[model samples]
Target: MSDIARELNLNPSEELDLLTKWLGRESTEHVRRIRSVHVANPALGLQLVWERLEESYGSPEVIERALFVRLENFPKFSNKDPQKLRELGDLLTELNSAKSEGYLPGLSYLDTTRGVNPIVEKLPYSLQEKWLAKGSQYKEQHYVSFPPFAYFTDFICGEARRRNDPSFSLTPTPSKTSIQYPKYEQPERAMRNVKRHISTHKTDVDVNRWTSQSDCSSFKPDDIGKQCPIHQKPHPLKKCRGFRSKPLEERKAFLKENGICFKCCSSTTHLAKNCKVALKCSECDSEDHVAALHPGPPPWGTENKNSPSQYGGEGEGPGSAVTSRCTEVCSRGQSFRSCSKICLVKVYPKAHPDRATNVYILLDDQSNRSLARSEFFDLFQIKGSHSPYTLRTCAGVTETSGRRATGFIAESLDGKMNVMLPTLIECNHMPDNRSEIPTPEVAQHHGHLKSIAHMIPCLDPDAQILVLLGRDVLQVHKVREQRNGPHSAPYAQRLDLGWVVVGNVCLGSAHKPTTVATYRTSVLENGRPSLLTPCPNQLQVKERFSSKIQNATSLRSVRHDSSVFDDCNLGNTIFQSTKDDDQISSSTAPKQSGTSTQ
Candidate 1:
């Protein structure tokens, strides 16, 4: 069934514009006439124009092919009067609106008639009975049933009665008479065919194995198992039947003889008790031994030894493997390795308004916060307080107490939309090659993007990405309109900044990279993101130490007091200061002993 419930709000002219703009050099007579109509009156509804042209030019399949578009208009009806038809259209429109807005649940195959029945009951009694009778006839005739919306649409189109005919039903007809066929006596032909199929299947399996082996060539010889451990055969140790057949005691002996860890069963570097690798016996939930060497009794309701329950249910236990987090000041030459959505925008620095330049801004909806290069801060001399943040990326978690700069203003090239950025965390620089950045020349190469190619700016080799806008600044990246083509083809999306081309725009091997790279960065803490905040005590201590260091470094010359004559001058000064304070206190204690005598 067609997706008739999908809402199409574009007017007739806009639809024609979409067809002509992206179809590119494939305008036929039917499309030309449609275009003429669109140019004449751009405010007409879609149904009105389709009604005029659909009869003269059947279906306009050429335009659909050129644009790669599918338009499922409400099916037409005959015999039914205009009033009831309009009411049905309104009801369908309401149902579609509710479904699109998520107020009503979508139709599923298990019971397609559930949500739609109540809506149909709101119609006239005669229409309801007619619909129900058609549904009963349909249920009796066809094994497969249309979705409720599609069924209603088919009924309106008068296909309901015709569909119940035997010719239209998919179910097989009952035989009127018995018939028989002679069987082949020779079994050799059947055996030969089966053998041929098996050989072909084996050849395909061999090819797949070769491909997997070639891709996994980077794996260590021991890890991939170049030779079986038990018999030294050219196969993985797990596939060695001799080792697997060995008794538990003998297996333990073999492990000790080979100096392999009992827990991991593969590692020879450490003993079982000292091994840090996270593994547990599947049979016993024991972390002490490998699953292969399981002893007799099956223990039920036993908790894993490495479970968090063993450590007060707070966090991962000591034996549990963890991704260690560390702070990085700046990361250079980190390849994005994939097609990136980028837009050109002007950034105005609060301190140096004259230094505003067009910067390539990467839009990542996966990221929750925005980031800018550390060098960008230095370029504008933008100063901000330190804010500690934990960044999680495809590589691993990284901790940074980086500066968060504010007072930066960004605007589209057209100057239509402007955003005052409150904060931008200092992250890292773009890769050196920057091959992932889409250029106008490459986008224009594809026919689909020819019309909008001028909207994309020319490649600026010297331009570096200064800011990466994440979901926090999603308003700037909201799609106003878009033009697209078939699968794997480049498409252009119009954002507030302007049109940006994304997808596999490269057509030749010369432009394609040797490897595929992908990276996603997000802020995560306990499976959720936490805010970046500065530590007050740490900031105060840092400020005091920095001030002292600045003062010490500024001194032009140093001299020791000649009268002191102490080798350890710094220590002696501290000691003498204490001694002088003691003497002053002793001298100031006026006649306290004499007063006590009275």
Candidate 2:
């Protein structure tokens, strides 16, 4: 019982109580008294409960013991009536002997049973004709033969219901003798409209080829023993008919949902980055990713490059209508691009203040609560309490247990203001909104203002976004002023932390436009994140001291390299290794190289 409880994540005492309550209601009076008199092992108690039920109701018959009866008075048989005496003895012997079998038939009451089978076989001549015609019609329409004998009764019953035959009824009215009979229902109307999927294995294209056999041992692929994630069938995911049939984006989402490695197309414990199996894509012969997850144009032929259809002119195809509809939606302030404001910041752990780590943070005012990656906690040496966290996003709801860290400090690149960050929830993975870094070149396109272009920091393309600051950190979100631009132009907004450009901004013809679309994510926690800020007195004193000792200190002892403090430096820091028996730790940090980052 203890082992069982541990396996099921339950308490042993609770398991005992549940079994007791269940058995107490269904057991006999003697068994109930025995249960009340003494405590028994839960396993034994459960067995006794099931055994009692089996004895009473498991078998089909009610009585198993034979019975005997005697007459009160009878006439005496003499020598002259030997035949009559012999007949009386035989009757008495048969009555006194043990019974051969019970009155019940003990047969399964399925379509093969006596009740429905005889009725289906001996249907009226008109009904039989209709049933035969139905079978023949199905064979002709589907280009297949009639169903197997096992399903014959079902086919006849279905035809009978369709014709509304009074003699052959599925749900007959209940009579006194048939009170416990099961009421059957006809197949739903939707089932009739379902399209049949014929087997494509044996086709004219490959009929002459040798049959594919599972028992063949001569040829085995890399995914021979693996099962497909999409169809849940025993086949390679890339070779699955269902997987190859879906569009590219859905295939990516399918891999994420099933936790299959995109590089190898196999479900393994290690991530794609750590995957040792090397597979070359057949499409482009690229070893970076599997052919199934190729990011290039789809295998299906695209429009001709020289044709007007390629440029999406009027009346090109049905796609033009969809494109125009999307344009209208975009004109109405709806965004279809994935973008957000991501900036680098230094995070100081409470336990290790001197070892501040550089981390990229996404400033999102729409999120009610901030979130950090679980890796951030280990890297910063921050300890937190475990708690159940519920995250709701545009996609769906995700419930998982996470840790809450309340001790942390966030600082800007220029080191102007220092603020204590609010409580942040740890998540296994962040939202999918990877966009091109907002560089200074992107800010130069707008003619409204370019005076503070130098102040607009350039985000490195290789920086890994580790944290998201929500509105809960109220101090950083206070908008001081804004430089507005013309319609559909990106504008710079000044916050307490620094200046940030927002909206779609085109850099050049070679570079794509930057998309700053908002992805709203709400985090539900037991305790709300309280806004925390550093004391004004402390900041004033620190600022004054720094001004007085500007040139006094010559030899500075810097723990990290000078490039780490630069605005464009996105290299990950190699921290000291910490060995723990329970948790796995890594000294190096992750880089944004491919799809393996998430």
Candidate 3:
């Protein structure tokens, strides 16, 4: 005998008490497993529901085991079959030798949905007509379908009452019985609505096409030319035959409830599923796909003039695809445009793998390489040589006289292979205005760049970004303009519908955010930025350090001529100082603001 049966036979009352207690614990464990199963198989469609009273075909074994456990308490549930509303089912299951695949009487009593094959489905056309037209007077026994037992309806109504959904109607067709059952309308559609299932696929045009198939299945496209049976005129299904088929009262209620025509779902246009204005692709004016996924040659031509291939294929190289990897801050795939607000980047110290620190990097396709501030090295490590290197910034050449560092190589972790792949370079470190972290209050939420900008914006903060990468590290992307109208301006329009990312190499088309401000780098003859005076007021400092400020011409204005200064003459030694000797310096430093121009 089973353990449960043996226990019940020995001490019926005490053993049953113990069994019930353990059932509660076991049910909790079962629910956790079922919940995970439900999430994993979400496409199961109302199968593994939590509420046992509702549709729960997926969890039949669990329910049966629990219900039978309740039956084990003889005195507690000795009345009839012990399971409520399932005496007939339990007895019938005994005949099948198991619960599964057993015929349960009134099992579908509470369900309102009609399956594909109803009782009248195979009946001749004349018998179907007679049954609907004659009702009780019809003498055919095979055609006369009756409701289940009256108590079955009461149980179903009680279940509905417990849920408190008053409008929850369960219209059950009767089995063959002599009871005077009320007429129930045939279920018009399945429980799932077509409109509710939309957006399961991508694009609006796909949604419209989906609704057309499910909602307009009764009428065929070829029927458009056929004359309506009621009006004897060539008209849409919703206008004549379909409308006349319903009773006068139902017709009035339908018009009152649905103010629009059934064919088009429109008040003005009463056409079929085919709308008057079809969906057109914004790129090629074709109805095949959305502009983002348009497969044909671009509107202008196959050759895009703004193609980066012409500009020497800026950021892309031959092997970028195999080496590209993204930081953890990216919530999406690496191929799309997202906010640069939170990004993590690793910077090595002049080819030294041991001194690499993962820091924040704001993607700037406009700048040349990743960057680091002098303050960052204080917290992290910095391997710099006595040799000085130059840096070109958005403002201009900001590092004409800093020690040139090289040991670090920028790298990304290849998650699939468990290897670190090198990026452009160990970002060149520069002195900023302050060492203190920027206040979060001053940082406003910047919307995504609407146009393609020369920047990548993932910063690992948890700290602020020290690096701004230009097209050199990013995959190459190109754009072509398409006019909105026949007479629209050619240059005025720009779409974010081209150049998708593959690994790190940009290959195809995907939607990207717009660029508000792009970092444009060019080779030009300009002067270096100028320095600020020590005095708080410009006039006071200008008088005191007039000669000093003139000598510090590299601080304010920037120039392109390579006047390479040695390590002694360069850097912020002559500027104001702050906590931990901030290279950007503090607010007290002249020509130094809260923002980092680098």
Candidate 4:
């Protein structure tokens, strides 16, 4: 023991040194015997070691060393003898008060089978505070399991109390007084008493064991299946013979054969009112006799009633059709009649001006030459005229006519010309009329001189000026020349007029030279010309002529004539002669002649 103690650095005289030497022996049987003896008298064994340590190393150092060894081996010995925990607590308290070389090592003991309790409660309040503070620091340094250490500490303090108290013992106590047994009744009473005692002891042992055992190992028997203690039967209610005798399906079939609900089996093909099994529908007041109750509103009566096609039916009241029609009328506008004659006679005639005949003119401003005539009548109006004139046709239809007697005015500062086509302008003027006619108002509004002036700037500024007057305005600005005298009005006054003739006009076959008689006639009344005579000589001839000039040579000449003859002859010769002249002329002439001489 001394040599082993020397090797382990334990004092030779110390009790722990001797115990360590004994514990290190190779014989397992001897070691087991020592453990058993320690278990049987753990308090006595602890006291013997403490006494030996005091004799060898003095009380203070021995107590300190004992505390370290006890804590070190605590895990090994704690379960072997429960009283060992009380012995350890006592030693720790003594070591904590004794003088030591350094701070006492923090001691932690874990009892794996126990739960947490207040063992520190048995400690002196000051030592408790000291250890608790030390415990906090120790917990920071060590990774000990919680609750186990706490339970062990509680058990140690409790056992310490038991050890200190004289009345406390591990052994059972006997009753202080006993009742005498009757000699004749002893055996039976003994048997009864034995039974009673057995039961009482069993209950006491259970309670005592329960108090000592931790929550981890505490026994619980109630987790088993239900039992009837009186009859010793398992699942008593479910096993009842009456409930198993008839199947639910059989009951349902039997009741239904009799035209009754399975639940109550009353008449009316439904369960009786008193039946507990009957289910009531939440949606409607009707009960569900065969199926579970459905949850929403009744399907039949809940459709929207305001739909159009549905308004004449079962739930509809009287006068619904009239009310619906009135609603439609309020939403839509009122209707009116649509007829063609109403539009033509009343609407169009009221809105548009009366139709008048159209006239065109041809002019050549470079030679100061121009031809002027009314297409249907010989009457003419010239340019620069303030007043308009009238023309009459051979059919005795008299129409008030004028030049394209209006000038266009530019609305913008830039003087942009809106040279609208005749058809477009006419349509605009008579929006309600079907026939095409150029009214005076339309011509005046559309033909502005400013628009014409703007067009002059587009031509070469250095180029010589030319003026062309339409036949409707030709007489007013005509150049009259003497036939055989020098003192004649200059054919045309030379002026810097910025105007040009850009396009031609097409006169129809009905066109003829105008005459005074033709000018005064009204076709609506007479339906024919009053004068139907044709010219016999060149001076008196009045014939329709092409207005075009051929090449620049004829273009320089102001006036040139072809031939004028009577219109009496009507044959292929007349048609041939007309075609020959049309081919010879460098102009798009008017079409065939429709007039006759009578």
Of the candidates shown, which would achieve the greatest lDDT relative to the real structure? 1
TM-score winner between 3 and 4, please give it. Answer: 3
Models sorted by TM-score, best on top: 1, 2, 3, 4
| Segments of candidate 1 deviating more than 4 angstroms | 1-338, 350-352, 429-433, 508-512, 519-598
Give the least accurate 10-residue stretch of model 4, judged by summed lDDT.
339-348
RMSD of each: 30.0, 35.2, 28.0, 53.8
Question: How do the predictions measure up, each by TM-score?
Answer: 0.30, 0.30, 0.19, 0.15
- Tens digits of per-residue lDDT, candidate 3, 214-255, equal 222222333323422122234532433234333444544443
lDDT of 1 by residue, 321-362 (tens): 322111010111232223457877878866654446678888
In model 2, state the lDDT of residue 134. Answer: 54
**Model 3, global lDDT:** 0.34
Q: Roughly what TM-score does model 2 have, to 2 decimal places?
A: 0.30
The 0-to-1 C-alpha lDDT of every candidate, in the order given, reads 0.53, 0.51, 0.34, 0.30
Candidate 4 per-residue C-alpha lDDT over 1-598 given as tens digits, one digit per residue, 9 for 90 to 100: 4466558775423544356466434433343444456755654554565455446555544545675565455442423354655676665454434423334333322232221223444344544564555455444435554433543344346546655555744564553221111112112212221222111121111211112112201111121113211112232212211112234454343333323333322222233454465444333545544221122212232223443123211233334232122111111122211101000010011112121112221132222222222221211122442233333233443434334422221111122311211100000110121111111221122223223323222311111111123233333224332111122111112112212211101111122323231232432222454543433452544344333422224322423234422422343124423324546545454555864433
Better of 1 and 2 by lDDT: 1
Which is superior by lDDT, 2 or 4? 2
Indicate the residue-level lDDT of 472 in model 2. Answer: 93
The number of clashing residue pairs in model 2 is 0
lDDT of 4 at 127: 42
- Candidate 3 contains a number of clashing pairs equal to 53
